[model samples]
Target chain A: MSTVERTPSQWRVYRSYHSPFDPCPPRTRYFNVPPNVLQPFQTSARKQFAPHEALRKGTLWPEYFSPYPPEARGGEAE
Target chain B: MKAIWIYEKKLQYPVRVSKCDPRLAKMLIEQYGGADGELSAALRYLNQRYSIPDKVIGLLTDIGTEEFAHLEMIATMVYKLTKDATPEQLRAAGLADHYVNHSHALFYHDAAGNPWTATYIQAKGDPIADLYEDIAAEEKARATYQWIIDNTDDPDIVDSLRFLREREVVHSLRFREAVEILKEYNHTKKVF
Candidate 1:
């Protein structure tokens, strides 16, 4: 599955409204729903990583990690 | 009898700068000393702990201590990037003012050479207000890391920065949780 399709529920995807009179093309598919919104009180994190992996990711829980690399960001636009 | 931070001999995440790039180092210095920098973050949370609710005091202490580890990581990166760099190289990288003042030594200053100032942080003594500020601070730090990742060519630095940015996300969520915890309390204690 593509990363977009695989994005967890914590990061919700929504459709953007494309207007007819707008000058720029619509970026319809993907925008962020910050993970916190899905969990109001955050009592616990269910899933976790091993010590080595946790150190590498900076979070023991995988759901919270969001990566921003130079390659996939659509250079000069993102 | 009190909370004491046991000395951790290493960074929370490994920090590696592949090659000497004084320019990149100068930019990364912002995280070390800018308004959204780790120093401000560490002090802000730690100072606010005394005034915050007992339920979230441990949360603030844990995140605040971790920020110190991040501060160390940043200092290590800056030192590695500028290691053995010549005065001319430093000047070309727009660190001329820093060089004249610190002479190859790292100083707490932003990418633009603004000295780290106490005005950069606050402790409102209100749990909800303080936690919200903490959340905002995390988002700001995350944005700064993303910008730095965009600007640098070093994969090693990007790797470390990506880790730090994710920690900010987690921290913000924890602060959000802290706010909710505060909200759930009955008003008999006279807390926010």
Candidate 2:
């Protein structure tokens, strides 16, 4: 005993004439995006690409491979 | 395929090893280069995504990318653990073999100093089979993290390891859901 309601006005029918084997896929109404929590990454990547390209290229991250401070070394025989 | 990538520039869990322990570092290297390690998990899923069904590719892609971040976390722990150890300390701790080859550097090798091999990962192009393998891979990684946690008394290191172990559980759940969705889709299509 189920009732069916019609909502044709809300539906947007899409047509794809290509065969199943076609390399291209039919476009959909929904576009997957980064979640709101991840929106910061999108903004950061945009900024990082601008002034930090050298850092991205590894040439500017000179401290990245620097050795740890001598005082931080703690494996002396007890 | 235009995609937006956001880089949250921080480690998911902080890695603070107060005392540099070369012995512990040697053991942690296994996670970086071990057969069932993060490197293997990342490559397996990333390579498989191209052939994955449209419905599940996103799951594989995101999980695979997260694995790369895990790999970085492990490498960071290893680096900090070996940071300032003397040759004598390293030799006594049984890490000299690795140091002789790489000189306090982080190399892609397991605990036994075996180099990472591409043979560690696989992509069968079948979503169900690959998802099953992914589940097993996550379990293997979680078990390894547990073993690390059990052996170490360092709370700082343990905290990071615990965080990583929890992530494995989450990934397994997501993969399970993806598998169920795939199965339902196939079933519905066959009927219609």
Candidate 3:
């Protein structure tokens, strides 16, 4: 006999209500604009914060979270 | 930066092998401490993090953490596969060498019983070089998983291996993206 096929446990869909504590609960922010809207101004649009700026702001961007502290250099430390 | 890890009380992929298979256990150990195993992957990414810039650091940290979880899963699979197995069974399956070393306990070693070593990975301070190495590591891991999948008949083991293999593919993609971001950062820095 072939290996028994077991169906994975079905997960219950939990609807997440926006937490009042969250000032921007996704979709609430206009950052993820549709490509059509973002494409035309993409070149001239206001540039987003640099990696360090995002880190200082505690932004969710991954680029800013270095596990190691930056080195003593004035430029972008390690 | 503050550490972002939250302990998940479960394996990302469940390993529920139905029967003890010592040979399978031995083979699975390669995924545990083999030259291209999860342990190496975790260490490689974690150690590589210090020199990486922002986004790449985050990616490495996250992927490295996930590799630890994968390491645990592999360890668990090896434990289950060898559980309660007799010396005769171990010998018959060519796992007597491992049994002699660890006595049915999970030890970090490859199928050939080579202990895990630090030399398996490199964190070369260059982000581009490290990311490329990360990508290659993931491919090697995916290949090992596929090889294990080919060798195993256990559905539970196969399913778990498949999940781990898919994760390697995803990690490769993320590392590739990190490489692109690093290149862009360097390009912009040069321009400015």
Candidate 4:
């Protein structure tokens, strides 16, 4: 569920068009964007992730974290 | 060639395969030698760095070295997935061809079984062009990981793939920054 408001959340969402003519049912709504696109040139920040947490998530900064579709923040909705 | 990067026995990210699925292994092998795979990425950046502007050369070296680490991770994933599976199982998974050639061994080949080659990569010698290619490679790798995650049912494999996918995003950003840095260097040269 995307909106007009511009919050600096890590993810940006988009919907795939559902075509009735297609043979199969459309997939769940919303795709998550990689966080890098939002901040084209990175800025210095004091925020950081703990070492273990960084290793697990693959990024030291929380803002760079981009979750998979299955791990998307909220439950899927039309 | 003397220790450009120190060797670390440990994987940058842990890899554990909870199940043995030769089918998934066959697909995952693409990352090992596919045209857009990490090996091509590593060689491309490493070769391109020798000719790029001094300010951006180290960044290329850094990212290039990390790409080797990523190749290791992909190898680990493919090995764990197929390690215990039998010849029959691999055959059933359309890896019969793979096993015949290199039984229970990993080869640098794509999902379709094409051998790795230098043609997959480019070293344009133009810093901006090379950086742009690096960025494109990163995004393509990210998309490939996402598709693999979509295909597989195993949570463990998906978890590792997600980490690798995120790394691509970070690499892409760094390359983009390198492009900007090169631009600034050109602007400064004109003023001087």
Candidate 5:
């Protein structure tokens, strides 16, 4: 006992941490425009051409280019 | 700048393809200007657009894209028709030559299976000439589609063909309008 050397002792401290686990709530729905306030907008755009007139002029050719010819009345068997 | 809007002005026609028969599909594809007409129309519009005057560039570009869509529709019809065709049926349809060469590739072949060639398109660099050619091309497409409808027995195919033929008529009108716009532009410049 007399031959042993003594050393100074240091103390260590520990602390416990906790976090809350609250969940997020659902969001409430909102509308920008009132249901009754919205209305379809109509413009006074002039008619460019009548349907038959446009048809008569062949101006719609690009749209009408068919790839099939008319079917024969009784030629389905061949 | 408004080229997209101009192109969007194209009218759409709904076409129904008959899935039950391969022969009808092959025949209907022919109306898409098969081997020559629809491809030619697409190539012509696209090629001619480059030569269009600076003033009419927007119009030309729009028409070119529309032609591209028509080409797609035509190709779709062709593919649907020949998807499961027998060798014998293909032969009877005179498409054996193409099947042997391409093995079901949806090519720009005529009813007889001839391959597409570039001589189908034209671009003279003159707006007037180009417009005239467009009008003629539209008529040819209409006629061909009409012929296809006449030859096919499927009602579904006929309906689609009729729609396409009507589209050609619409395109012819649009080209005529473009020509009118060009004429007006030239007239104003002449006065200036």
Candidate 6:
């Protein structure tokens, strides 16, 4: 019943990269809001969220402190 | 502990100046020790902080950083104001003195067009004296910002000026707090 067409090349490329990690879970979700709404709808769950959650959501910690060089990590003692 | 140095690492702030207006840029440069007020504030806070006692070191360090931010804000304003300026407007604003020498590049100079010099700042190394001087300097900056805001018709310029003015107020409060802390330290030592 489906009318959508898929090319052989598209299927091959998709199959080639298909691995356990290919369908990794999303880190965040997007919400769609109605244009007519005057005020943003507040989620009750967000209200009681912990401070760490707020920090993770709001702050750019990763950008502020980048990782050290690989050599700086130090090798095992011989 | 050592102080953390922060670099803006951006263009850092840009200002859009029309060909018709150039005086505003010339005036904003005053804060960077350009014509006198700002550069003086930056140099004053930085130099004076070094001599402050350990008890007030944190406060001094914070104020010094704020001074650096103000310097950036002023420089951004100057850049915006001077951007796309015509030769006639620049000459009329007496920016010719700067453009003639620096070629449209911004430099710290006094209101009278003298280049910024280190003699503008004093660091006596006395906490009490330094605190007093800082309080006075903040007031001077606040007044300067107020004047700039009052004189400028541009909303963008006014907005930046107002922000700078509020910062001056905040810095003044912090300096006062530092003074109180120093006084308390003296009191506790006396009691012991």
User: What local lDDT does model 4 show for residue B95?
Assistant: 93
lDDT of 3 by residue, A1-78 (tens): 122222221111122456688786533111111121112111334545576654233222232221111122123111
Which residue window of length 10 is worst by lDDT in model 6 chain B? B10-19
- lDDT of model 1, residue B182: 79
TM-score of chain B of each: 0.95, 0.92, 0.93, 0.94, 0.81, 0.86
Instruction: Estimate, for each residue in A1-78, the C-alpha lDDT of model 5 and write its tens digit.
Output: 112222121111222332355354432221111111121111244344457645433232222222233122122211
Worst 10 residues of 3 chain B by lDDT: B183-192
In TM-score terms, candidate 2 sits at: 0.67
Off by over 4 Å in 4: A1-21, A27-32, A70-78, B1-3, B187-192
TM-score against native, each model: 0.83, 0.67, 0.68, 0.86, 0.62, 0.63
Q: What is the DockQ of each candidate?
A: 0.52, 0.02, 0.02, 0.64, 0.09, 0.01
Better of 1 and 3 by DockQ: 1
Candidates 5 and 6, the one with greater DockQ: 5
Docking class of 1: medium
Native-to-model Cα distance after best TM-score fit, residue B153 in candidate 2, in Å = 0.3
RMSD values, in order shown: 5.7, 19.9, 18.0, 3.8, 27.9, 21.3
Give the TM-score (0 to 1) of chain B in model 1: 0.95
User: Relative to the unseen true structure, what is the C-alpha lDDT of residue A33 in candidate 3, on a scale of 0 to 100?
Assistant: 14
Give the alpha carbon lDDT tens digit for every residue of B82-171 in model 4. 888888888899999988899999999998999999999888887778888888999888888877887888888888889999899889
The lDDT ranking, best first, is 1, 4, 3, 2, 5, 6
Candidate 6 per-residue C-alpha lDDT over B1-192 given as tens digits, one digit per residue, 9 for 90 to 100: 576787876432233333345777766666776423766776677666666777777777766776776677777777766767777778888788788787767777755677787776677778888788887777677666655654567755564565566556556666777777777885665434
lDDT of each: 0.81, 0.68, 0.69, 0.81, 0.58, 0.57
Greater-DockQ candidate between 3 and 4: 4
Q: Pick the candidate with the highest lDDT.
A: 1
Best-matching candidate per DockQ? 4
Q: lDDT tens digits, residues B21-91, model 1?
A: 89998989999999999999999999999988788889989999999999999999999988789999998
